[model samples]
Target chain A: MESTRPKWPWIVASALILVWTIFPILWIVMLSFKRPGEVGNQKGFLPKHWTWDNYRTVFRTDLFTAALVNSIGISMIATFAGVVFATLVAYAIARLEFPGKKLILSFALAIAMFPVVSLVGPLFDLWRDLGLYDTWPGLIIPYISFALPLAIWTLSAFFREIPWEMEQAAQVDGATSWQAFRKVIVPLAAPGVFTAAILTFFFCWNDFVFGISLTSSDRARPVPAALAFFTGASQFEQPTTAICAAAVVVTVPVVVIVLAFQRRIVAGLTSGAVKG
Target chain B: MAAITMKNIVKRYGDGFPAVNDVSLDVRDGEFMILVGPSGCGKSTLLRMIVGLEDITSGEMLIGERIVNRIAPRERNLSMVFQNYALYPHLTVYENIAFPLRLAKRPDEEVRRRVTETAGLLELTEHLDRKPSNLSGGQRQRVAMGRAIVRQADAFLFDEPLSNLDAKLRGQMRTEISRLQRRLGVTTVYVTHDQTEAMTLGDRVAVLRKGVLQQVGSPRELYEQPVNLFVAGFIGSPSMNFLPASVDGTSLSTPLGRFEMPGEQAAAAVGDRGVVLVGVRPEHFEDASLVSEDKRARGSIVQVPVDVTEWLGNELYAYVPYEAPADLAAQLRELSRELDSDQLRTQAVVSLDASSLIAEGTEAALWIDTSRIHLFDPATGENLTRDEDHAARLTRAAEPSRAAQRSTQQPTEP
Candidate 1:
């Protein structure tokens, strides 16, 4: 709407932001394709000698493959669990009337704001004592707990945006309570659910503190934690390029998810939902 | 279709404040009943209770002979149109209208046929495949109407359905709804806060104020013989003007002038020589030059300078501001507040004929019809010149045709 302003400022600002965000990922991808000797001996930002040796080495490791499977399986389970529970809680918070409703919202906010590192020490001690250490449930349980507040807050805002009269009209049109929920409300909330699932998956996928603190082996270690334990093809070889290859592989899912749901995520975050 | 009857219905919230207080009314079979009032008057609360969406704290609700207090909304066999249209955003017009039939597990063929047929009735055949989001406001409203009518439920409840539309579209939809109701002969209970909608759409309109039923009568009855000051000010377009008056024998003293009160109207006044409100509709006043000499002699004429005049094509409105006693001004202020209208001052509007040429700043002779004047008690806000029981009787008289039809096995007569 401010058409009088020069257009160059926005183009320059956009280029600066793109460089700022993409520089690190580009460096990692460049390193992933570099020879082991050339990684620490970089002549410039771009790799002088490129090879598939690092990617071959990363894919050939049992530990890396095992951790990749663990990360995918655990993050998916946690995302599903968190989103399902969040939907119920969000629906209650958004639609139903009860005492202490504000208290519930405040509680969710407090948990979301709570520092994850502060809970790591206690969680580590508890997991070990309960024999859940080095297990998939150990990581998944914390992932769900941490992801719930985000999912709940986002999903609840989305639920509140829906017109309540549509639900009542469904009932008056001869749908029972459950039918009304399934037939009318659920389809309307599908976009919000997708948005919540993506966010929860991203949270669980990118977690490092819980994965490292709770699991000592690849049995439950996610890719972020597993990347630290990567060894080269031999004891004398540096594993920097192999680790970079693994990091690049792990970032693929996040990129794919972001690209697939960029528009929906923007809508979910910005949808005030009060308009007709 | 069924007649809806409420017996001493009360809707009290959790805090024990009654939103709808001990209200009782019967909506006859196939009759268009309008529940109208200002916001927070409990008209919507009453409509919600009938549809089983809100709990009736203590009351008996009857759909024909069956009590529906314990029934759920779906089981109560009624349909409702919301002010927002409430159409499912995900469904096409065909699917939206077919939803109830599909819910009841009707045959797929039957659902398709009925949906197409209903869409045709609402003139939505061309947009049957379109979602609610793709349609315009008026089209979406019609789709909502199609959804309500597809199943032929026991009754249709409309909660200010036309309020979301523009004035022109609202006028169009109003006549469409009236035509649909007449063609279908479906029982309906509509709730709206607009007095114009209430006056035009209802076969019988019930006016409410502060959770109590103020008056229930035909539009003509409520307009011509209001039960109280609130109804008088609430019904008409340029609402009836209330001026402080004092009664002494047959003649009433008002800020405008002294006019002879008819014998029947004077007898309706309660105490002698007490302050009363004299209400005269705007249409009852005209330019003295426009009236016959014989008719002009039958009423009082007041010469007042017109502050402003509006020529509205069909009629002309002139505003005549006067000075009233402080107590009377305060009384009119309180009366306007109770009516949910703007604060009233010492103003009288004389709706003269368009040809009268009553220009502003000029003194105009305005003849008032003394017989049509309504007298009211300032303290109680009751109409002293209209019988409340007569208005009630007029409303109740609408129920016998339905009752007679229910009692006989013969087919209903037109």
Candidate 2:
């Protein structure tokens, strides 16, 4: 049945979707290479005079550099913390039976589904009162909390796929419980851990609502939120070209991350852990 | 290396259901003991409890002379091969075999030496650097065995280790495991529902039904003088045929026909009960015409209509259908269900020589060895004619050969 279908239509559809998605990213790249003065001229898709001035300007600004550091530091911390906590929680949820386990899972799903926008106003007020406003901790706390539910869900699914016999065989082979978990369970779950970490990192990196509403300075402002505050060389000028450059720079890590760990994320690492 | 002794061991789950109920077993040093039953019979649970993976609700478990009921699995110093051959996927075969030694903080020199030796033993040397995911099912199974054997733990426990393999591979691995166990001379407790594994691999076998221990004896003893109906029905392929019979002096009337037996044989079989179950193994019945004249005179012959016949090159099996009493039919149905067989109708499977000319839907005369048949009390399922002395003699006769085999192989091991 599948072979009988003409191949051209499917190929055309896929090519159309590919261009639709890549066109915006291509436009951003083109805009980033344009001169700041030419951004508003509405020239052709290619920059009339391609220049490195915008990229140079993006790096020269203290606000952009500091925000870059803040973004990297905050996302890494949140992803590390979220993945560690989720791994333990997911292992318990997958491998153990306890009262309220279903309740906890449902609660996690609820939090994951809760609107981030609704929590912003309340969290902003809470952070100010708690002296956490305009700080890395302020942004990190919310990022980890938001990232945890999804991380736990992904990790637990991976954990459940792992056969319990692997750990039992380890224990019977003269490993303590901790050793069995570290040597057998953890290695089997490495792909899951990497996947959850990348997902959490992406969440923290691309966040704008909390980054914009809760932070007020370069001290904790991430790249997405910091881009909004960029000013040109003069009062009447817009930093459109510089902002595009910063956007392109920010997207590099996300792309590199997905490319580097894509195989690990997609591979089923538990394949030979037990018999089919 | 160690004898594992369980005394009145009981395991009760949270719902207060006993999974292993008051079972006492002794696996002597250098003995291969098999725990076998149909699914949900707690054979695997019993193996888990011995390894300290499951907590015992009551009674004592001893490894060697140490009471290991409170000890964790690792500290108990026993290695187990799981039914699934749980090899660590991320580790190379060499690293997997070296896992236990590494856990014990053994020197790298010794770890390398031991792993190499074990890998050689299981024929896994060429796959040393390859991860489990790259190996075949049989290779992965060998790696799992290598990991277990490299530890040189007190004893080895196998939980249906060959069940995951294909039939031909299972047969080959069965012999491999048997040879390995004999070479090591370790106290091994193996749990499997396959009766062939139980009979072929173990020096003695324990049969369990509904978490209750039925009988523990040498395989020959269990095969020849089963204590009850369940063991008789469970321990063989093409299981024993149960015929509802009523005792009347020296003759017993069965659904097949009335059979007159010698007075001594009848006296041993006839208890206070008037109705009993007569267990006749399929091989005990032969084609009457094919039997030797002297053997034919020693046993009785029964004429019955053959319902079906299967000829498998080497031997022929003839099925004789009969009308059983309603109450006994229900009893047999329940027994068959427990034994993992679905026998919706009452029939006798009679094994005959391949040369026999028996055909389906025809009348045939089958000679039954009357002296070898067992009589069971219908109500309690206990064997009325179980000869305890004879069973003991069978077990006693098996010991010297086992000790001789062990001694001959002792010098080969370090």
Best-matching candidate per TM-score:
2
Model 2 interface CAPRI class: medium
Per-candidate Cα lDDT values, in order, are: 0.87, 0.90
Q: So what's the TM-score on candidate 2?
A: 0.97
Best by lDDT: 2
Q: What is the DockQ (computed on Cα atoms) for candidate 2?
A: 0.67
Over A172-243, each residue of candidate 2 has an lDDT whose tens digit, in order, gives 888877788889888888888888888899999999999999999989999999999998655677799889
Clash total of candidate 1: 0
For B57-95, candidate 2 gives per-residue lDDT tens digits of: 999999999999999898999999888888888788999
Which residue segments of model 1 deviate by more than 4 Å? Answer: A272-275, B268-273, B387-414
Q: Give the C-alpha miss distance for residue A129 in model 1, angstroms.
A: 2.9
Clashes of each: 0, 0
TM-score, B chain alone, candidates in order: 0.93, 0.98
Question: Positional deviation of B334 in candidate 1, in angstroms?
Answer: 1.7
What is candidate 1's lDDT per residue for B1-414, written digit by digit as tens? 999999999999989888999899999898889999988999999999999999989989999899999999999899999999889888888999998899999999999889988988899999999888889989999998999999979999999999999999999999888778766778999999877789877888999887889888888789988888888998997889888877776777887778778565465555564678889999999899899988887778987889999999999999988777787788788767766776656798779899997889998889998767888888787887786676667656755743453345233565
